[model samples]
Target: MALDKLIGLAMLAVASAVFTYYTIWVFVLPFVDESNILNSFFLPRDYAIKLPFLLLLIAGLGVGTFIGNVLIKKAEKEKLKKSKKSD
Candidate 1:
């Protein structure tokens, strides 16, 4: 259980870091230039994917993944408690 928690925390930290980087890059890319190298991220392309209203979708995905993992762990812990109680 301790190991699982540690791994989950580590993964969440990494994902958060990646999310921050992408968020900042996307925000600053346009200021750089219309044909700037950073423009290759195709962030604008994503805007028109007709998915969401903001460009934070990538970071949102990271957050969602982290939350899902955490919920799964919590459910596993609950199941363990139930099993022990049954015993």
Candidate 2:
């Protein structure tokens, strides 16, 4: 349960960071002059647009895999207990 909470918090932080970056890149940078130092950190418009979606997809896959593995292990443990009881 603690691990689950930790993973959830970590994912939340990552998602928040990505969303914030995407917002800044898409909404804030356009108004800044091309020569501004901050502009250098900004992604190209197309890639910036796609970044948050991609990050979300990746995070979803990772969380899904972690949960699946945990469920599989639990099933295996239950199976082991049943077999041991019959022995």
TM-score of each: 0.40, 0.64
Model 1 C-alpha lDDT per residue in residues 1-87, reported as the tens digit of each score:
699999999999999997776666656654786777767755564554354455477779889999999999999999999999999
**Candidate 2 segments exceeding 4 Å error:** 1-21, 33-38
Quantify all predictions' global Cα lDDT against the true fold.
0.76, 0.90
* Worst 10 contiguous positions by lDDT, candidate 2: 43-52
Please state the error at residue 33 of candidate 1 in Å. Answer: 13
Which candidate comes out best when scored by lDDT?
A: 2
RMSD of 1: 8.8
- What does candidate 2 score on TM? 0.64
Model 1 spans with C-alpha error above 4 angstroms: 1-55
Q: Look at candidate 1 and tell me the lDDT of residue 76.
A: 100
